[model samples]
Target: MHESPITGNGDVVKARQAVRVLAQEARLSLVDQTKLVTAASELARNTLSYGGGGTMRASIVTRGTSTGVKVVFSDQGPGIPDLDLALTDGWSSGRGMGLGLSGARRLADEFTLDSAPGKGTTVSVLKWAR
Candidate 1:
C-alpha cells in the first residue's frame, strides 16, 4: 500500500502520480491508467479544497484471476450535507465545474462515497486491469 498526504496542489499531483504508478504496476491498460489517474486527481483536489486537508491511500490488489488498483481519499472537513446533491453532475458547492464526484464515479469501476454534515468524507475508487 502507498500512503500520502493531500494538503496542497502538489500533494494532489503526487496522489495522481502514485495512482498512475500503482495502476501500471497492476498491469492495467493505458486507458485504465488514465481513467484511474483522472479520478484520483479530482478526489485529491476535493480532499484539499473542500476537505481542508486529508490523506490518500493507494494499493494494488488481486482477486482470483483479476488484478486492480484501489485508492482511498479521506478528509476531516465539513462533510457533504446532501450526498445526492453532491453526486449530481452539475452541482458544485464551490466554484468547480461540479463534475468531480460524478465524473470520478463514471470513470471508476467501483465507487464508494461516505460523508455527513459534521463528520468527515471518504471516497474510494477501484479500477480493474483488463
Candidate 2:
C-alpha cells in the first residue's frame, strides 16, 4: 500500500499519479486505469478543498484470480450532514458543480462513504481488473 497526504494541489496530483502507477502495476486495462485515475483525482480534490486536507491510501487488492486497486480518502474536517443530497447530482456545497462525489461513485466498481456532522468523512473506492 502507498499513502500520501492531500494538503495541496500538488499533493492531489501526486496522489493521482500514485494511483496511476498502482493501476498499471496491477495490470489494469487502459480504460480502467483512466477511470481509476479520474476518480482518484476528483476525490483527492474534494479532500483538499472540502475536507481541509487529508490522506489518501492506495493499495493493491486481490480476490482469488482477480486483482484490483483500492483507494481510501479520509479527512478530519467538517463532515457531510446529508449524504443523500451530497450524492445527488448537480448539488454544490461550495464552489464546485457538485458532481465530484457522485461522479467518482459512478466510475468505480465499488464505492463506500462514511461521514457524519462532526466525525469527518471517509470514502473508499475499488476498481477491479478486467
Q: Which stretches of candidate 2 lie over 4 Å from their true place?
A: none
lDDT of 2 at 42: 88
- Candidate 1 — which residues are off by over 4 angstroms? none
Error of 2 at 11 (Å): 0.7
lDDT of 2 by residue, 3-53 (tens): 999998899889989999999999999999999999999899999988999
lDDT of 2 at 67: 99
Alpha carbon lDDT of residue 116, candidate 2? Answer: 97
Task: Tell me each candidate's RMSD, in Å, in order.
Answer: 0.7, 0.6
Q: Encode model 1's per-residue lDDT on 65-123: one tens digit a residue.
A: 99999999999999999999999999988757999999999999999999998799999
Error of 1 at 112 (Å): 0.2
Q: What overall lDDT goes with each candidate model?
A: 0.94, 0.95
Which lDDT value does model 2 have at 83? 98
